[model samples]
Target: MTQINITRVLKGKYTIMIVLIIGIILYNIMNDENLTFTENIIGRMIYTYSLFRNVVSLTNYEEIEKFRSNDCSIYKNLIFGFSNKNELGIIVEHSIGYGENQEWSILDEYESLEIENIMGNRHWIEIDESGELTDGISMDMNRELHKDEVVVNFIVSKKLLENNNKLKQNLIRPVKCSTKKLCSNLYFDESKVKVVYENDNISTINKDDKAESPGIVIYVHGGGFVFGDMNTYEKVLQKHAIQLGKLNKPSIIVYIGYRKSPKWKYPIPLEDVIASISWIHSNAERLGLNPNKLVVLGDSAGGSLATSSIASCLSIKDQSKRRNNNVLSKRFHNYCKWVDHVKFLGLIYPALCQKCVTNSKLKNYKFGFLTLSSLLWFEKQYQSKYIESYFDWRSQPLLAPANILRKFPKTSIVLMKSDILYDEGRLMYETLLKLKVNAKLRIFSGFHGIYGSSWSSGGSNALEFINSEISEIMNQNN
Candidate 1:
């Protein structure tokens, strides 16, 4: 053979050997069903390298989707990253057999008017001349309706609500401080009060009695619809209350404990939030709360709830205007009385749309501490068989009708650039602006739950942004 031909053959053999080696490495990485620690580490490194290349090349949408759908676990872990061990620990802790092997129950009854009252103006009943409950709807009617529609719409089976009367329980149960003591504590300093409305205990924090009535902030805590309560968020709430008090703004901070999902289904949590708003409106005078200057603030899942609650209020208002019946109109009007009072909405890295979970754009994106798989898992646990039910604005606020979006209050959206929901938050802000709703967007470089760690170096900016928004709202009213 000629010398040149021999060289060509050698080069071809070398190229084939390299390709085979690469193929074997990829096959091992992809085919390992139950990877050892060492194998997992190697797999992660390879996945990360591939992800980096794809991102740098600006991979097309189809290719990204194919990659994500092909290997969900590896894709998720790679995007979630291993740098934040603390975050990884949280994910593992929360994901251990998350939704499986749990007790389930079917809600017994359905009551449209009862549900409506809970969703609308259930707080409006008053003591008549005979000192008896005097609302137009009868208990019998509520019972009959409960057997029908409420069961269909609001019922779900889950471990959290099965044994415990969690629906009526106070969210601050874990605080170790009674209402009176909490009010007197150093953090609260006579600025906190606990009140029960509709069998649900809510915490109200404000300034000293002599201070002027201030704007109201109805705060909803986030736990992915399964874990958070007032006690979990008390310190942050206290800090905001204290800061506002010192400024002489004296805002009434209402922490609502709504029933969570996988325990209570779709409309239940939303209705509970609405009930709290109704309670605030009914007692606005006594609480020294300025109803016209109300701000609804929520983080993560709570942001979704906050947005939906406002949408519900707006819906109730529209319905009330179209109805002529004095009784129904009165109930809806009472429910909607607080709608106009909502002057601002603060969403901190909110899960605005579940559909965003499967969006192709986020397939290669690093979702900070939250992984796409975990988000999907939570969504399944929260909605369960009612996945189709999320099409409405009640579950996904971004899916709200244009008419409703137009009526949304001035919104201040805080998005952590690293969060999976960041794009959705920006989309929501832009959509609000397109609908002519007053809106502002602030993006920070942080993780999903950074807002809760306000004292941490990474979260301080988010905390300050929130404080400034509150200050701006107070100034507007002043």
Candidate 2:
């Protein structure tokens, strides 16, 4: 070979070596620096990456169809949806398994929601029993809708929501506080919210311009605060649609997307969540949904957020109780001042208390899908550094004052036996009862991530319980 040929071969070898080294680093080490690098560098190429994942998921759609209801097919018309991927600063395990034994057990240990997400338009990444990821999805084009469902993709102008609330807070500030300084520091974000309902002879379908819905269920999703988006939880929304249809309560189900943490911390996620509620209440009359009847449902970490949101709502609703507690001063933006409208709260295996380490956590946290290691990591990433204390009720709704807990809307706490978060769910239920806040608690067999899945007998039963609880809440005072 000539000298030029030798130089080119050397260059090729160098390139291969660099690629191999990077891959090794990524495979073994997934710290903040590694993930941030991925988010900033590789994530920008999501348009192409998403295209490949979308193709893979399209193939899985055929197999996952039986598990999905017709109305749940969010990717029936797949559009490149990588832009919709919420970049989490750190990735925590929401249970690929608890430990090595749990991992080696069987494929049955995985939730069907794992396989059910095969049709997720932007989020189809499923870690199989082999611990290999073989799927993904992205969004580069406009979100599409299935023929049978009235799926309306809407944007909550979080920036606008924050500014409007700033004005309100400035208006309501106590005389002691300085008028020159704003009462609440501002957090600006843009959130994607989807409104899904059955297509039952609706005349207009202009995204958010109009909709035909009787009542509404506002859903918040969980991914250990590191992952999860509207796409990942489409099946849960579909489950809601199925139950609502069965109960003859046909309502608009709104799924909201908040920014992931470590990249975006604490109050920002909470802010995005409450803003969705305010948006719904403001537009209920226009959307043809009953403003007086609304329910908020959340899973895992989302349950904590949902609880915090309602706690914020209660703080705003009953200010007399806010006198002594300094945390109560951390009011959420005028989140749907129609607090009376939120009829109920549904929490599925929620992480309610940041400080509690119950018997269940001691036993199941090490061997469950939601492992104790992941929970500690999640709290570290998800909690706000700016806050005065880590255990504040902002994230730990279980710690909210007794008076506020007393005023909480009717709530249903659903749990799974042998799950890490079970005891806390029970704790919340018992506390609610102590406070005389109309609360119901149910425990089913199996582990976390089962309530929204259809794989195991336990998952099916848990899902049924959730459906029934939500249905009862929707029907109450109707």
Candidate 3:
């Protein structure tokens, strides 16, 4: 080759290396708060080397058919430089925010692959090969593209996941089933908290109870996209745990203080329940429980979570990517760790479909905060993140249980007379029965959130009502 041509080639290579190095350095410095300016600069260099290695050394797929032929799922990725079939790690390529890529480089980066939009403009990557990662772009008119954001998700192989000690430990943690009566002054280290994986982690206040004893039902409380915590269900969980203990055949009850919304949504909370169920099983011996003799319960928003969590476990294949022909082989790791088997499922007055229920709720409460607040917020942040189809009831099935009725665990549907969510629970119950899933329908005569209130603080007869159904399920399961 001519000298000029060689010089041009070398320069292009040098430029790519420089940009990668800068990107890595900036990322590290951005994360390091403890570093002085100069120290940060030094740390930046240290960070740049690792980042450079990841970008330059990773696998590349430029051909469309080759990429399409590989096994690819949101949950699988190949390990960098580890050619051995057994040693790949989960690596993801994602661009931030909501929108189509303004930069052409990303198009070139993901060329030849099909992208399928799932929820709210979030697209799933599809390649010819099951798990192929490509450096080229393909034009897919059928796919929905968000305005500025794009992400390619894939889990590393089991071997790679295991080798990364930090990642493995980070994903799973010990469950603490507190026997101590919860009060306003309850102390917990939220930082030290980790998601449980085995049933052994479930602790009950009444651990000495017998095997045939009634099962304690735990509810994971829910708030809209944002709002609520363990405190939301504090009275509900405590009242029943205490009541079950009083029955001598004292049952064990547990509630998840899961990480919450906007920041941690969807998969994070779902994973938390999976971990909690595992913990309940692991601690069954200590907690004097029968793993099979249990009922998982939730109300409203939590019901959606409980149902989704169950669906996540029952399906062996990745339901999210099941439609895409190119994603099967490349998807290595299963996102769900285990199926949470419970004797009964309980959903009381739940906002199962946000699009359906929210519109109705907005109509009646006419003058409230949500309408004005969302409008004001939208006025300020009205960037068309994605010029795509507007979300409606049919578009977002993940938020509703209408699609996942088959294989549903035995369930009891509870609702109050005046609550807005009453219709939803009733509809869901009807659907479950239509699908031939073993389910029961019950209507408690009360207002929304006011089960049978006594004169005591935070008193609600809902606990007594729910416990009765739980006892029947336990008895039947036994």
Q: Pick by lDDT: which candidate is best?
A: 1
State the lDDT of candidate 1 residue by residue for 33-77, as single tens digits.
333333333334434344333322322323433433433333232
Locate the minimum summed-lDDT window of 10 residues in model 1.
87-96
Stretches off by above 4 angstroms in model 2 are 1-213, 320-333, 365-368, 387-391
lDDT of 3 by residue, 1-478 (tens): 6456643532344534553466455745464332234333333432333232321222322322222222111001110111232222322211112223111111111112233332232222334575552223344422333221211111223332322333323223332433222111221211133232222322233422222423445565554423344323333444455444434233545565443332233433444454455444544443334555666777655666676556644442344246466353211122232244466787766556544544334433111012223322211221121313333221122333444556677887776543455556777787888889898876654434433233211114455667777756655635
lDDT of 2 by residue, 340-374 (tens): 67888889899887557888777632222356655
lDDT of 2: 0.51
The Cα RMSD of model 3 versus the native structure comes to 21.3
TM-score of every model versus the real structure: 0.57, 0.56, 0.47
Number of residue pairs clashing in candidate 3, backbone atoms closer than 3 angstroms, sequence gap of 3 or more or interchain: 54
User: Lowest-scoring 10 consecutive residues by lDDT in candidate 2?
Assistant: 88-97
